[model samples]
Target: MTEYGYFLSCEEFTPAELVDQARRAQQAGFTRLAISDHFHPWNDAQGNSAFVWSVIGALSQAVDLPVTTLVTCPTMRLHPAVTAQAAATSSVLLEGRFALGVGTGEALNEHVHGDRWPSFEERGEMLEEAIGVMRELFTGQQTSHRGRHYTVDNARLYTAPEAPVPILVSGFGPKAAELAGRVGDGFVTMTPDADMVAAFRDGGGAGKKVVGGVKVCWSSNREKAVDVVHQLWPSELLPGELAQVLPTPAHFEQAGKLVTRDMVADAVTCGDEVEGHVDTVRAYARAGFDEVYVGQIGPDQEVFFDAYRELVLPALRR
Candidate 1:
């Protein structure tokens, strides 16, 4: 059976709001939670980006549901060693209910430290090495490593979880998917593409969990919801590698101007029809995703959860 989850948008909400949402998600029958990690929101209009680790810690206390980073970048802004320590501590804090979802990262977040953005190939290699380093550190034993992109000398995680934390790698293309399959304990992506899932399995992700996420806007007023997404998350509709390469929120804002309300309406599930929400999630399940996380694009979260609890979720389960 596929697990259903809520996607927590750290970029758009405060930590307190996120914790509250987590509680509500659990109450609304979302079995898990996925939070995005970012140094900056995709566009300034979204206007918030909390430190994800701190939010995860609070989540450990606020809800019993398992939590995963929708995709954190261990290769850039922070060294792999620091990310490993943080992930290990999070697992311990969540009492083993944490999974680390990681990706090669975007310049919007990774370029903040004045480090030159590497090419995609270089980023992938760096990610593979970082994953290796993190896996070693999660063993709770002193670890040392010298790799192509990073080096760790006699580092250890003092607060490692009793069991190793599962690492879910995010991929957007075939190469990245293969990399995820080759090195990740599981796989994550935003689309419900069965061919992508098959590629992951064929590349060695067979038997691993396949996780996907979708963004929707649930409102009685469909046009208002479309407007909200158009204002807050137009970056979602940006084409190609723009999301991965855009260096700043301003750049995203500039590019996002091209995304119209019509595109968003066509792409995202908006408005109050329970059937639309159920069908959106069911697409992921039908594509063989083991887990699907749904996020309401704007502030209509309460309405979304209530609708899911009263109508959408039960239909999907049935």
Candidate 2:
């Protein structure tokens, strides 16, 4: 069975807001929760970036639903050992209801220390090495690793998880999916692309979980919803490598200008149509996703939760 969950966008919501959303999501019948781990928001309009670990702690206390990092970068901005400790602590806090979702990461979040961002190929290599380091530490055993990308000396997670924390690797393309399959316990991606899922399974993810997420807006006024998405999430429509390589929010803002309202209307599911929202979310299940998370864009979260609780979710389940 495919589980329906909610996505908590750390870039767009404050810590309190995120915690509140998690509670509300649970009340509204969401089975699980996923949250983004970003050091910076994609643009100023989004206007928030809270440390995801802290929010995770709050979420553990606020809701019973399991939480996963929609994706976090362990190769840079933070060491894998540190990330492992955090993940282990989070799992302990959630009583083993946590999964660590990782990725090579975007320069927007990873370039903060002034290190030149490595190419995707190099980043992939680093991520694989980092995952090895993390898995070793997750066992509560002392680990020392001297890898090309990172060095950890006799580091151990004393507050280790009671059970192994599943590490889900994120990817947007086939090569990344293959890498996720080769090394990850599961695979993560945003789109519900069947071909991408097939590539992942063929790359050794045959029995592993496939998780994904989507964003939609439920507004009484469709045009207003489109405007909100256009203003707050135009970066979603940016072309290929632009999202991965952009160095700062300013660069993203500059590039986001190319995305128009019409494009957002055409590409994003906006407005109060229940079927539209249900169809968008169900696509992930159709693509073989074991778990699908849906995020409601903009400030109209109450209506989204209400509608999903009363209409959309029931329709999808039907």
Candidate 3:
């Protein structure tokens, strides 16, 4: 049987509401929880981007489900040394039930400090070195790194995990997956592409766990849900260079005129029907994911969870 779970998109909920949602998810039979780490929401319609680490702290006390960052990048907004400590403390707070899912972040999240957003090459370099810094701190060693992207001076992680907190690297490209396989404890990607899994393993990430996440929109009023996600998340469709020139949600919304509800529905599951969503997730399990997480991007978390707990999870668990 597949172990079904929930993924809380932090962009959609307030800090306290997020904690409550996780707790409710636990009560509803979710075995694990993955929270998204975003510094900013692509649109105001998306509404709310709380610091994920703080949300994790509350979830630790409020729920029993294991937690992982769907992804956080220590390479940019945060120094790896500090991220190491944060990860360690989070593990402690969760009583050793936390994993750190990391990635080379997008400019939308990392460019907030008015810092020069390095090219992908520089970001990869930073990620490569940052993992080393995290590994050193995880070992409970007093360490320093003089790398091209990072310089740490006599750093130590006081709160190390009782058990190792696995580092799962999120990859969108071959080089990133290769790096994850080389440096990470596990590999994470959104697509259920086994060739990508094999690539990660081939890159020397032997025996690393593979995890995937997918989103579904479930509601009796499917059109409402579709409109919400489309209105808020049309940024998903912005083409290559166009996304760069578009600065805000309003820009994206204006550009979103090019996108229709069908486009959103084509990419995302749209409807209250539960079995189809189950099939959607089972596809990941069939693709060889050790674990798969499903997210509802519709409005009304309470109704979504009720229907999911009563309707969807049973089908997936079987």
Candidate whose lDDT is highest: 2
**Candidate 2: stretches off by over 4 Å:** none
For each candidate, what TM-score against the reference?
Answer: 0.99, 0.99, 0.93
lDDT of 3 by residue, 58-140 (tens): 88989988898989989878889889999999999999899899988866677777787676777778888998889888887
TM-score of 1: 0.99
* Inter-residue clash pairs, candidate 3: none
lDDT-based ranking, best first?
2, 1, 3
Candidate 1 — which residues are off by over 4 angstroms?
Answer: none
lDDT of 2 by residue, 77-123 (tens): 99899999999999999999999999999999999999998999999
Model 2: worst 10 consecutive residues (lDDT sum): 273-282
Clashing pairs in model 2? none
| Alpha carbon lDDT at 102, candidate 1 | 96
lDDT for position 26 in model 1: 98
Taken over the whole model, the C-alpha lDDT of each candidate is 0.93, 0.94, 0.81
Q: What's the C-alpha lDDT at position 278 in model 3?
A: 80
For every candidate, C-alpha RMSD to the true structure in Å: 0.7, 0.6, 2.0
